[model samples]
Target: MTLEILTADTLAPVRHGFFTRAGGASSGVFSGLNCGTGSSDQTEIVEINRARVADAMGVDASHLIGVHQIHSADAVHVTGPVTTKPKADGLVTRTPGLALSVLTADCQPVLLADAQSGVIGAAHAGWKGAQAGIVEATVDAMVALGAIRSQIHAVIGPTISQRAYEVGPEFFEEFMDEGPENARFFAGGDGDRMHFDLPGYGLSRLRAAGIASAEWTRHCTYFDPHRFFSYRRSVHEKAPDYGRLIATIVL
Candidate 1:
């Protein structure tokens, strides 16, 4: 199968994609474009998958840079490929030849680009990273690279939606502890469980960062087994491991 790349018109002139698990070399649980080097998939296969993504972004495989994704409000500024990926959740680059990639199973993979400033960024935003302000941090980093936050366009890729993201009371408390206004992002679930709108929260954060425009692609990773890899779905099904989908943006 050919690689399935989801794009948005809002990010005009930026070579970006939300890659699905349609075309890759891996098999079993970690099948289809598992570009996550941290995954249990074969290292060689992961390299091949990442190379495919890099090619699609019109850059050398080595130019596709990623981070350790610690789910924190950290962003790295990249000028060139590194021998070792840094321990950060977001990456911003003013370099034209580089592509920033973010790996996620159910977490939001957000791509930001400012074609006028020749700056682009990618962020891994799980609940922790999003709540901790990773999205705002990425926008700020892009501005330091000469990208106007008002000129930046951010689009969130595939992720688990609220209807599929059942959470415990403790999970709700975590958000409440941060701020009580966050309660609007949740809905009633079974008993004390609540459904969190992760993608919605991601967009809210991006918009709050003063980005000109931001939106989610409406692709739910947990609900769609054929197109995505979902960590929560894997756990629910009792799978040993889950695959990761890669989203990339090149300047």
Candidate 2:
């Protein structure tokens, strides 16, 4: 099967994509391009998936860099390849040979670029990482790479949508504690449950960070199994593990 790489007009003229699970060698629970070595998926299979991504990006497999993605606000600035994936939720690079990438199943895979400044970034922004400020941190790191705050464009990739993201009151409280304005990102669900808008929250953060342009692909991972790999869906189905979708950006 051919790789079904998703792109946005907003990030056009820059080499970037939100890759789907259309082409890969892994099977069973990880049927498509499972780029996450952190999962229980086979190491060899994960390596093959990543190598395919690197080939699609026209770079060495090692140059398609990603982090350990600890769901923290932390961001890493990379100029070259590194053997170890550090513990960070975001990555930025001004160098031409390096491609910044992020892995996600249902969480937001955000790609950012300041084309005029020749800098690019990619982030894995789940609810925890967004609440902890991963999007803002990615913007800051891009700035350090000579990008202007007002010149960056961010696009949130496929993620679970609000209708499928039911959360308890405490989850709602965390956002409410941040600010009541955040309540807009939620809609009342069954009783104490509330549906949280992960992509909406990511857009709010990107816009708040003063990005020049911000948008979402509006692709819902949980709702599209044929084109996406969704963690929440896997859990609901009692799967042992799930494949990870890869999103990439290169300068």
lDDT per residue for candidate 2 within 57-175, as digits (tens), equals 99999899999988899999988999888999999999997889999998999999998889899999999999999999999999988999998999999999999999999898888
lDDT of each: 0.92, 0.92
Q: Tell how far residue 250 is off in model 2, in angstroms.
A: 0.6
Count backbone overlaps in model 1. 0
TM accuracy, model 1: 0.98
For all predicted structures, in order, the TM-scores are 0.98, 0.98
Which tens-of-lDDT digit does each residue in 1-251 have in candidate 1? 88999999988898999999989988999888888898888899999998998888889998998999899999999999999989999999988888899999999999999988888999999999998999999999999989988899999999999999999999999999988989999999888989999998898889888888999999999989999999999999999888899999987
Output the lDDT of residue 225, model 1: 97
**Model 2 alpha-carbon drift over 4 Å, by segment:** none
Candidate 1 regions exceeding 4 Å error are: none
What clash count goes with each model?
A: 0, 0
Worst 10 residues of 2 by lDDT: 5-14
Give the worst 10-residue stretch by lDDT in candidate 1: 30-39
